[model samples]
Target: MTRCDWAENANELMTRYHDYEWGVPTTDERETFELMTLEMMQAGLSWQTVLNKRANFKVAFADFDVTKVARFDDNDVVRLLNDAGIIRNRLKIKDTIHNARQLGKWHAAGKTMNAYLWAFVDGQPIVNRYLSMVEVPAQTPLSQQISKALKKAGFKFVGPTIVQSWLEALGILDDHLATCTVNHLSK
Candidate 1:
């Protein structure tokens, strides 16, 4: 079976993530929010770490339910910090909960995160051709704009780098390699 071309260092977990989830269009608000939180938590950490504990994160964060996560309190923070299932970082855990609350506000304002986020690209994915992994950029002007907007919208942990990663993961930015088996949109 053919698979998406990935870096040689990618292990089974990363390979699976790249094949199944990377550059896939997603419109679900909950899924988008979940990935946003996960990516934020992945700031200094590797994507593999986030993927490995994704199930645990879902359980701990109430399946990424915006309402529930937005309502997390001090006690919840403490619980998450002590939970081995997810990352034990206090700051990121707090930011995750905080960002959920802000996202809820945005939703209540009749502004869905999907709509708000997709607006950066004028409601379309930005396909990028790359010869290899090194050719892929870490941040782009589009991501910078999105990051600025997200910060203005009161989101935390959403710098340009994280926003770029989100764009790629959600198919807003397709960074598939030219020779990738799953290079359908690379052309």
Candidate 2:
């Protein structure tokens, strides 16, 4: 029943995420966008805090549907700002809308969101063998490259650290500890 140590202290919300979602590879564009949005919202805050408010986020942001969110306007911004169920940070909330627009632009430009996201790692998930959370990195050079590229592509709120988490969330980077039963690359 062993898991990544971080998940040990995770509440039911996090435990479920770790067990079912974390580290699982995903290629769906909408799902990828959702993960990136959630990870972006997680910046400067805890995953649990975001997880606790995930439902609110989903509801507020059109269930993480990038297309619908991309259409959000000033009125949507005002509404989100006044909501207590989710983080009311104006910049982050506004950025979600901007990020969705960027996602649409990418799609319009013939870019496969999934392929573009996976290209950083050459269409493969990175398998790590950390023994503990301390050995895990907050960011890597590849993550930095991806962040820079994504920012260049017009995405907001995506820094190296945030991109790193996004990569993990997309399962493009498998950081599960060697001791974790869910470790995908354990020997």
List ranges where model 2 is wrong by over 4 Å: 183-187
In Å, residue 12's CA in model 2 sits off its true spot by 1.3
Residue-level lDDT for 153 in candidate 2: 81
Clashing pairs in 1: none
Clashes of 2: 0
Model 1 residue 73 CA deviation (Å) reads: 0.2
**Per-residue alpha-carbon lDDT of model 1 for 8-122, expressed as tens digits?**
4578777767776788777789989889988988999888889999999999999999999999999999999999989899989998999999988888888888887787778
| TM-scores for every candidate against the unseen true structure | 0.92, 0.94
Global lDDT of model 2 = 0.86
lDDT of all predictions: 0.84, 0.86
Per-residue CA lDDT of model 2 for 1-187, tens digit only, reads 8889989977899888887778888888888888888898888899999999989988888988877999999999999999999999999988989999988887888886799878777888888879989999999999999889888888889999998998888888888888888643321
